[model samples]
Target: MKTIHKIAFLMIMSTQLSFAQSSEDQKIMQLSKDKWQWMSDKNVETLAALFDEKSVFVHMGGSWGKQQEIDVIKNGGIWYKKATIHDVSVNIIDNTAIILTKMDLLAVVGGNEVTNPFIVTEVYIKKDGSWKLGSLSFTKTLSPSGK
Candidate 1:
């Protein structure tokens, strides 16, 4: 009877842990979605607050740091007009969260509008009770069949 009770208690604890992890994952996912909108809207003030000072950004044309990324968005250098997110997954390890997003990005680069399929990786680190984006990298990928 004692052994059975122990097993049931362990199972309940495991289920609670799973629920906690799921909640954290959902928060990160929502943050990522909001980030895409902020970028599309050129909300640099909010983005600057979310991005860590040491954050890095990788693009098809080049890679840059947080300030340069903000400048690019503010100056319309590479306007992130829209992002149609097809899929997203987030994993949390310790105080860091890594997110993988599959999406179609519509943007204006050098005044030319284009659409591309990309797998975007975003890393966020929790510090002082808040999360800050540490890195964002975009990898161009071939479009899936049927748009």
Candidate 2:
């Protein structure tokens, strides 16, 4: 009788833990959407809040720090007029999460305007009960001409 009671208690505890984790994952996805909206509106202040102090930004051109990303946002480097996301997959690992997706950005690059599609990988980390982006990597999908 004692062993059966203990087993039941352990099962209940595991189920509760799984439910809590699922809730957190949902929140994380919502966070990503919030960040995307912030970027789409060119709201630098709000987007800046999404990145952690020790975050990394990796673009096809180069890698940048949190401040660099903020500077670009403020300077309109990305000029993210609009964006669309597709085929997204999110995975959680311990306190870390990874999001991969195909993204299309209507942006201005170096004085020329264009719409570019890229494969993006975003990493987020949970710290002090809050989740913030730890890293972002993007690989441009080029045309056959490689332009």
Best by lDDT: 1
Candidate 1 lDDT, 1-147, residue by residue in tens: 999999999999999999999999999999999999999999999999999999999999899999999999999999999999998989899999999999999999999999999999999999998899999999988872213
List the candidate 1 regions with Cα displacement exceeding 4 Å: 144-147
lDDT by residue for model 2 (35-146), tens: 8778767787777777998899988689989999888877878766766776677799989999876778777766678887877789999888788899988778873122
* TM-score for predicted model 2 compared with the true structure: 0.80
Which residues of candidate 2, in runs, are more than 4 Å off? 1-18, 142-147
lDDT (C-alpha, whole model) for all candidates: 0.94, 0.81
The residue pairs in collision within model 1 are none
Mark the 10 consecutive residues where model 1 has the least summed lDDT.
138-147
lDDT, model 1, position 95: 98
